[model samples]
Target: MTQRTDVVVIGGGQAGLAAGYHLRRLGVEHVILDAQTTPGGAWQHTWDSLSLFSPARYSSLPGRLMPVQPGRTYPDAAHVVDYLADYEKRYGLPVQRGVRVCAVHRDGAFLRVRTDCGDWRARAVIGATGTWTRPFLPAVPGRREFTGRQLHTVQYRSPNEFAGQRVIVVGGGNSAAQIAADLAHARIDLTWVTRRTPRYLADDIDGRALFDAATARRRALDEGRADTGGVASLGDIVAVPPVRAARDAGLLNPKPMFSRLTAAGVEWADTTAAEVDAVIWCTGFRPALAPFAALHLRGSRGRVATDGTRAVDEPRLHLLGHGDWTGPASATLIGVGRPAREAARQIRDLLA
Candidate 1:
């Protein structure tokens, strides 16, 4: 049997849930399809020690605030997972779990979302599948030739496995810093490498500050004002407690990116080489738009050209929570609400 919904939201993460909340508020009938068997979305798979850069109050969805964790300033991943599960239940959002959407294709006037369980025909589709599942590993020479164990940010968990082993952590972003901090005491030898010198935000700055700056920049751009650098002008890495402690202790030493990976380890342009046990690539992720491949909507940048959240070529499609391309700070828990609301409003109008 073919299921029919007014809107079909792909991925029941923070983004999908936000979209569902708004759609329901606007009286738009919709169903969210999630690949995970349970709630929490990407938060379920994050490292055990991962903590939000801000307090629970700053990291929340629309219509509800995340509860504060007892004795914790920044909520951990498990707390976030609990909040998401509770959020879904509280709102009675229509989310079908364990339904892996294969592709979305046009069926006359409606879009058919083909999944493993069944088919759903929707007037509009919201692509809220965040980049967690699609971890990116940069192509470095001799990567395949390296005999050392290799992994990406997604595969990383606690740092116990690397104990008494030499490890090289790659990337200049927050993940690299956090993971390096996690492994600081766990590993006997650790090397953190980045494309450039890692930039750290002021100790007092966190996600709330970043989100507000992004919003201001977004407003300026929308109002035809000069481009303020916004968050980009600030810094790359947030000086979270753990990161700050690690940096102060002189444990998080970042070196320039290696020239190539040898059979045993990484080699720099200076011909200096380091033998290591493993390499963790924190290079980040690309948008997970594989299901929309048939639409041919992505451009050379591997992004769907959009005016706000709506796709230019395919007006029926809205890309939500991917990144800034979808909306300013759209990928964060606090940031996704704005785009989700805008997407829902556009969807409501489209249906009308």
Candidate 2:
């Protein structure tokens, strides 16, 4: 079945929900197509011990503030899921769940969004599909030959299964730090590895500070002032409670990345080898853009070039929640609001 709408938001996550809220406020008729049957978005798949870098008051969507969790300083993944699910319901957003957008092609003046359930033709399309589904695993020699288990962040649930095992957690980002901390009490021989020395953010800094710094940097650039490097200049890892405890206990020390995977484990350039039973790659993810592949929008850097959230090659196409490329800190719950509002406003103009 082919349905028609003024706009079709191609995700129902935080980014999509934010865009839907703004579109609804602007009196734009739009439908949100979500691949998942639930409303939590990517937060639903996060590990059991994951916690937000910021407190509830600092992490929220455009119109709603996340409620504080009793006895907890920072909210966990479950709390975030609850908040997102409630946010969708609170706004009464028009979201059609269990619809997977397979491809999006131009159909004259409208964009044809082909999905598993049906097709939708809309004047504008907002690709808010986040990156959780597309976990990035680097190609290391002997990876396929490794006898032990290997998994990425998307597949990681809890450290219980890895208790008493020799595991290596790879990456230099927040996920690596948090997962390493999660495994600290699991009675496992854990090895934390990074491409470079891990840098810890100031204990007082959190997502709110990062977002404010990014905003200031953006404003400075807009005013042709000297560039004040924002979060990038600060550090990579956030000292969440778990990470802090693990660091204080000396369980979060990281070794340099291994040169290559070995049949039994991994080996470094110095000829040092370790027999790891499992490897949890906390490496990051790329944007999930399979539906937009038919549009041929990727530029030289393998990213869909955009001005703010609007795709530069396709005026009616907008990308959201991918990363700083889409908008500064847009992938964060609080940071996505501005870009979502801007995308909705542009779509409104385009439809008008």
Candidate 3:
């Protein structure tokens, strides 16, 4: 069946839900297509111990705040998943689950979102598919030759599997630190790898500071003022409780990134090598814009060139929460709402 909607949201995650909230508030006819059978999108697949860097008050979508028990502070992945399911139900958002969008093709005036279930002819399309499904795996020379078990952040679940094994964790983000920390007490020997020395924020700081800094810089850009936010980026690791504890325990011994991978393991930058059983790549992800491949809208490094969240070449297309380029800190739960709201407003105008 061909379903016609004024706006078609490609994801039903935090970004998509936020866009739906705004579109409904503005009275735009829209339908949300979700690939996952349940709510929470990528959150459903995250590690059980994964926790947000902020409290419930700071981590919320547009229109509604995440509810938490008074004593329980920061919500974990399950809490987020539950809240997302509740959010969708509370707003009565039109979300169709298990409808994986295969392609997006432009036909004359409208954009046709082709999914496994049906097709949607939308005046505007919102690409809120965040970068979770596509985990970035580095291409080391002997990467394929390594016989050890390999996994990315997307596939990682628990530390039990690598309890007594020598594991090499790659990347400099919170995921790398958290995973290493989780494995530290499991009697596992761990080696951390980073391209550069990771800069960390103070112990007192968390996502609140990150959100504020990003919001300020984004506001400056929106107001036509020079971005004077300096080299302060939200990507810098924050000294979260667990991460700080790991550092204090002398478990965060990170070496400069390795040069190449051998049959046993990676050769360190200093030419010293170690025999490891597994390597966990925490290197971030590129946007999942495979459905939009027919549009030829992607530029260098698979990035969509956007004027804010709207695709430059295709004005009716809005990509929300892809990254900072799409909108400042647009990947964060708190920061995503700004871009989602703005994109929905812009999409509303386009449909009108």
Candidate 4:
């Protein structure tokens, strides 16, 4: 079947929903296509213990803010999922679930969104498919020869399953540290690995601070001014209560990355080998841009080249929630709305 719309927003996650809300306010005819059965996008697949790095006030969409209980703090993954589902209902955003967009090819003046369910031809397309599905794990030598279990953040569910096992958690980001902490408490022998020493943010600093810092840097660049400083990014783990607790318990220490994967385990820089039952890689992810592969977008390094969310190659195309290249902290909840609103305005103009 084939349908037509003024705008097609792909991926009904926070970014797509935010863009949908803005488009609705502008009285634009749009439809959001979600690959998943439910709303919430990648948050539904995140590890159970995951929580927002900032409080609820800082994690909201354009017009509607995320509600928080008086005494409640940062919301968890489940809370975020519930909120995304609720947001769609509140705004009456037209979301068609279980529709996986296979590709967005040019159909003359309009774009043809080829999906599993049907084809959607739209004047504008917003690609908000986040990176959770495209997990990245480095190709260490002898990796294929290893007999032990190898896991990425995508496959990692909980620490309880790894109880009493020798495990190595690799990556320098929050997921790696958090998983290590959880595994450590399960009485598992855990080793934390990073390419370099992990930098801990100030105890009071959180996601908001990181977003502000990114904005500052961008502003400096835009104004053609030299910055007197550089701030850490989202990778800087929030010193949340749980993280602090883990620190106090001496479980967050990180070691340099190992050289290669051995049959039993990994070989270190000093030519030392240690056996481990499981290796969990929290390395990172590339943009979920398979649908746009035909577009031949630039910026090969896990991000799309965009001038404030507008694709450099395709004027009617907008990429969001991939990372900061689209907008300052665009991949984040609070930060995504800013770009989403802007992108929606541009899409409306294009359709007009």
Which candidate achieves the best lDDT against the true structure? 1
Q: Would you give me the overall lDDT of model 3?
A: 0.86
Model 3: clashing residue pairs?
none
Task: Return whichever of 1 and 2 wins on lDDT.
Answer: 1
Best-to-worst order by lDDT is 1, 2, 3, 4
lDDT of 2 at 188: 73
Candidate 3 regions off by >4 Å?
69-71, 222-226, 229-235
Sorting all predicted structures by TM-score, with the top scorer first, yields 1, 2, 4, 3
- Cα lDDT of model 1 overall? 0.94
Which prediction has the highest TM-score against the true structure?
1
After superposition, the stretches of candidate 1 with alpha carbons farther than 4 Å from their true spots are none
Estimated TM-score per prediction? 0.99, 0.98, 0.95, 0.96
Point out the worst 10-residue segment of candidate 1 by lDDT. 181-190
* lDDT value, residue 19 of candidate 1: 98
Clashing pairs in 1: none
lDDT digits (tens) for residues 249-277 of candidate 1: 98889899999999999899999999988
Greater TM-score among 2 and 3 belongs to 2
Give Cα distance to truth, residue 339, candidate 4, Å: 0.4
